[model samples]
Target chain A: SQQGEEDPQALSIQEGENATMNCSYKTSINNLQWYRQNSGRGLVHLILIRSNEREKHSGRLRVTLDTSKKSSSLLITASRAADTASYFCATGINFNKFYFGSGTKLNVKP
Target chain B: EPEVTQTPSHQVTQMGQEVILRCVPISNHLYFYWYRQILGQKVEFLVSFYNNEISEKSEIFDDQFSVERPDGSNFTLKIRSTKLEDSAMYFCASSSDLEPQHFGDGTRLSIL
Candidate 1:
C-alpha cells in the first residue's frame, strides 16, 4: 500500500508562474522530502523538512510541512522551463526507508 | 563534484538470465538503497543496506533480489533470474546519518 498521495496528478503553467503541489501521507514521519525527476532520469533531491520544521527553502523552492495534517507542499516561485519535471514527495519513517508518492507531473510551458 | 555514480547506464538481457547492477555511492555515506520505477509509474523502494547487510526491504524485493557491498565504495544489486516484470529503471541512493538521500542516474534494464 502506498503511504503517500499527491494531489492534482498533473499541472501546467507558464514559465514565470508559480507551481504548487501537495502531498499527504498516512503514518508518523521522521522527515519529509521532495524530489524532482526529469523524464526517464533519476530523482534529484530538492529539499527536506524535519518533523519539527514547518517550512524550508532552497533557491526558488519552498517546502512546508504540517505534521498535524500529515501533509506537505512544495512551491516553486517564478518557475523556469528547466524546473519542469515530475515532483515526488517521500515520507521517511522509523524503518529508515522512504515511501514515495505517485508524483505530480508539472509542465512549465516556455 | 561528489555524487553517486552507476554503471552501464543501460542493460538488455534475456529472460531468466542473471544480471548485476552496480553503483558507487558517495565516499562518506553509510546507507545504501535500491529503487525501481517502471515506465510511467511511481518509484518503488526495494531495499536498504547498512553495515554491509540489509536492514529493510519492500514486498517487491523478493528472494530473487540481493544486494552486496563487495568492497569499499561499491554497491551492487543482483537478480538471480530476470522476468519480464523486472524491466524497469533501477536507481541506487545513499545517505549519511540523519541526512537526505542522494540518488544515482539509474540503470535502465530491459528483459528480452
Candidate 2:
C-alpha cells in the first residue's frame, strides 16, 4: 500500500521562483524521505527528515515533517531549470521497507 | 558515489514465459530492494532482501515472484509465468543503515 500522497500533482514555475510540494501519509514512520527523478530515469535521493526532527535543510532544499499532522513538505528555493523533475516522498516504516507516494511533477521554466 | 547497476535496460517477453531481471548493488551496501512502476504510476515496492534472505515483501510479490543474491555481487528478481500486467519499469535499490537508498536506472519489462 502507498503511504504518502503528494498534492499539486503538477506545478509550473519560472527560474528563481520557489516551489513547494506537500506529502501526507497515514501511518507512523521512522523517517520520511524526498526523491527526484528526471524523465524516464532512476530516482535521486533529495532529503530526509526523521520523526524526532521537525525540519532539515540541504543546499537549496528544505524539508519539514509534522508527525502530529502526518504530513511532510519539501521546498526548493531559487529554483532553476535544472530543478525540473518529478518529486516523490516515501515513508520508512522499517530499516528495509519504504512506501512511496505518487509523485509531483515540477516544471521550472528558464 | 557508488551506484546500483541493473542489466538489460529493456526486455520484451511473451506472456506465460519466465524472465529474470538482474542488479548489482553498491558493493558495501547491506540492504537490497526491488520496486516497479507501471507507466504513469507510483513506484511500488515489491521486496526487500538482507542477509541473503527476504526481509519483507509486498502483496504484489506473489508465488510467481522470487529473489536471489546468487553471488556476492549479483541480485536478481525472477518472475515465473509472467503476465501482461507485469509490464513495468523495475528498479533495484541499495542502502547502508539509515542512509537513503540509491536506485538503479531500472529495466523496462514488456510482456506481450
Candidate 3:
C-alpha cells in the first residue's frame, strides 16, 4: 500500500519538551504533508515538504523529507498542553490523491 | 480563512438505504475530494473530483458509490445502498492547484 507507517504510535512529553514523530513510505511522492486532528475533529494542515525539498517549517512545527529514503519526520518544539492530538503524515502521489499513515497520538502534559 | 463545510454532522440510517452526504468546498478551489475513516482506521480516499468529473477513485469507491457536482459550489457523495460497513466518518476537502487540502469536520454516518 502507498500508506505510510509512523513510528511510536503514541508519544507523551512535558509541555516544554520537544516531540518528534517519524514516518516512512514505500513509494515516490510529489509531496508529504503533516496534519493534526484534535479528537473528533477534522484534520488541520501543518506543513508540506515537497519531494525536492529536504525540510520545511511553519511556526512551531518543523518537517523534514528524505525522498531517497522515503521517510519524513515532524518535530513540534516547546509543546503546549493544547498541542495534544493525533498527527498524521500523508503522502501525495498521482492524481493528487493522498495516502495517510496510521498517525501518532501525542500527549503533552502541562 | 476559507474552509470546507459539510452538512448533517451525523446521520443515522438503515441498511440498504440510500444516503447522500453533502459538502460545500472552499470557494474558488478547483479540486474536491471525499475520504472516510472507519473508526480507528487510517483515512482512506474515496474519490477526487475536478472539472465536474471524477479524476481518480479508490477501489472502495465501487459502483455502489457515486459523486457529483450538481451545482457550482456543492459537491456530493451518494451511496446507492448503504451497508453496516459503510458506517464511518466521511470528510470533505478542497484545494487549489497543488496546495494543501482544507478539510471539514466531517459527517458521522451510522448504518444500522
Candidate 4:
C-alpha cells in the first residue's frame, strides 16, 4: 500500500521526558515527513527526511530514516505538555502524493 | 510565511446535497492537492492538480468528485450529491516544486 504504519498506537509520558515513535512502510519512497495534529486542530509539519538522508534534526525534534528496512523514527526531546498530540508519518513516492499512517496518539502529562 | 487558506470552516448539509470546499493556496505554489480525513481515521489523498489539470487521483476520487482552478488564485473541490459517508475534514495543501506541502486549517463537512 506504500502507507506508513506507526508503531505504539498510543504513548503516555511525563513532561521533560523523551518520546520516540517509529514508522514502517512497504515500498520505496522518495521522502518521509512527520506531522502533529492537536485535538480538533490542523496538522503542523514537523520534519522531513529524504531517502538518501540518514538523519535530520530541528531543535527538539530528531528524525532518522533507514532505507534498507523501509522504516523511520521520530524523537522528541524534553517534551512538554503542549507536545501532546497525534503524530503521523507520511511517505511520498512521487513528491506529489503522500500516504499517511494511522498516527500515534501521544499524551504528555504535566 | 505564506499559508494556505480555506473558507467556511464548517458546513452542514443534507445527504445527497452538493458541497463545494474552497481554498486559496500559497501564491507561489504550483501544485495543489485535496485530502480528507474521516473522524478518527488516517488522512487520505483525494486528488492533485497542476497546470490547471488533475495530475493524479486516488480511488476515492470518483466521478462525483471534481476539482477546478476557476481563477488564478482559487482552487475548489466540488462533490456532487454528498453521501453520509462523505462527511469528513477536507484539507487543502500546496507546494512548490518538491518542497514540503503547506496545509490549510481544513473544512469540516457534516452530511446528515
Candidate 5:
C-alpha cells in the first residue's frame, strides 16, 4: 500500500539549466528507480539507487537516497531539449514489483 | 541490446469484451511483469511472473485478470471483460540476473 509521491508536479526551465525532482515514499524499500516517459510511451529506466547507497551518478544524472526520510532526489544537469519528459520515481519492495509516483513533468524549452 | 517486445502497439476494444495483451520478455530473463498507466496517472503494477507462476499481484489484478506464460518466450495478461476504466498504456518488462527491468514500448488499450 506504499506509494511514492514526487515533488514539483511540473517543472519548466530553459535548456542548459539543472532540473531537480524529489520523491518520497510511504514505507521501506529495497531500491528506488527513476524513469522517463515521452508523452504516451513506455517508461525508460534512468537510474536506480539502493537503500544502502546514499548517492549514485550516471553521466549527467545523479540520484540520492535518504532512507531515514524515505525520500529520493534526481538531478539532471545540463538539460537539453531531448530531456523534456515526465520523470517518475518507483519504489521497489521485496516482491520485485514496483510502485510509481505521480511523476514530475519537465519541459526544457530550447 | 535485447528488450521486451509488446505486440499490437495500440488496441481499441468494446467495453465488456475480452482482451489479451501479449508481451515477449527478454530472451534470457526469468522474471516478467505487467504494469498499466492511465493517462496522466502513476504507473500501477498488475502482476509479476517468475518460474512459470505469478509471484505477486496487485489488488487491481482481480478476478477478471489472469496471467500466463504458456510458451517459453511469451507472457500474457488477459482481462476477461475490460471496462472503460481499463483504458491505459500496458507495459511489459523483464529483468535478468535479478537486475533492473528493461521495459517494452507498451501497448495502449482504449476500451470504448
Candidate 6:
C-alpha cells in the first residue's frame, strides 16, 4: 500500500532556481527518506529524517519533517540540468517496512 | 559505496509460468525488502525479510508469491503462476537499520 503522496505530480524549473517538493503521509512513521530515480534507473538514497527531527541538510539538499502534520518537504538548492529526475518519499514503519509515494517528477531546464 | 544488486535486469515470461527474481543486498545490511512498480504507478511493498525469514509481508504477497534467502547473500522472489498484471519492475532494497533503505536498479518483468 502507498502511505505517502507527493504534491506537484510534475515540476519544471530553470537551473539555479530552488526546487521544492512536498509529501504527506497517512500514518505515524519512524522516519522519512528521500530518493532520486533517473528515468529507468534504480533509486539513490538522498537523505533521511527521523520523526523527532524537524529538519536536516545534506550538501545542497534540505529535508524537513513535521510529525504532527505527517508531512515532509525536500528542497534542492541551485538545481542543475543533471538534477532532472523523479523524487520519491518513503516512510519507514516498524521492522524496516517502507511505503513509497507516487513520486514527483522534476525537470530542470538548463 | 556499497549497493544492492539485482539480476536479470529484464525478463520476459508467459502467463502461468514460474519466474524467479534475484537480488544481492548490501553485505552487511540485516534487513531485506522487495517492492514492485507497475508501469506509471506508485511503488508497492511486497515483503520484508530478516535473519533468513520473512519479517513482514503485504496483502499482495499471496500463495502465488514467495521469498527466500537460499544462501547467505542471495535473496530471491518466486512467482508460482505469473499473471499479466505481474508485469512490473521489481526492486530489492536493504537497510542496516529501520531508516534509509538502499535500493537496487530493479528487474523488469514482462509477462506475455
Overall lDDT per candidate, in order of appearance? 0.93, 0.95, 0.93, 0.95, 0.92, 0.92
Better of 1 and 2 by lDDT: 2
Off by over 4 Å in 2: none
lDDT per residue for candidate 2 within A1-110, as digits (tens), equals 43899988999999999999999999899999999999899999999788899999999999999999999999999999999999999998777889999999999999
- Candidate 6 chain B TM? 0.97
- The candidate with the higher DockQ, 2 or 4, is 2
Clashing pairs in 1: none
Off by over 4 Å in 6: none
TM-score of the first chain of model 5 = 0.97
Find the number of clashing residue pairs for candidate 6. Answer: 0
- List model 1 lDDT by residue over A1-110, tens digit each: 53678878999999999999999998889999999999988899999899999999999999999999999999999989998899999998753688999999999999
DockQ score, prediction 3: 0.79
* Candidate 3, position B71, lDDT: 90
Better of 4 and 6 by DockQ: 4
Taking the tens digit of each residue's C-alpha lDDT, what string does model 3 give over B42-99?
Answer: 9899999999889989999999999999999899999988999999999999999989
Q: Which ten residues in a row have the lowest lDDT in candidate 2 chain B?
A: B94-103
Q: Which candidate would rank higher by TM-score, 1 or 4?
A: 4
Question: Each predicted complex: what DockQ?
Answer: 0.79, 0.89, 0.79, 0.79, 0.75, 0.77
lDDT score for candidate 2 against the true structure: 0.95
lDDT of 4 by residue, A1-110 (tens): 99999988999999999999999999999999999998777788999899889999999999999999999999999999999999999999887799999999999999
For the predicted complex of model 4, DockQ is 0.79
Docking quality tier of candidate 6? medium
What residue runs in model 3 are displaced by over 4 Å at the alpha carbon?
Answer: none
TM-score of chain A of each: 0.95, 0.97, 0.97, 0.98, 0.97, 0.96
Docking class of 1: medium
Q: Each candidate's TM vs. the true structure?
A: 0.97, 0.98, 0.99, 0.98, 0.97, 0.97
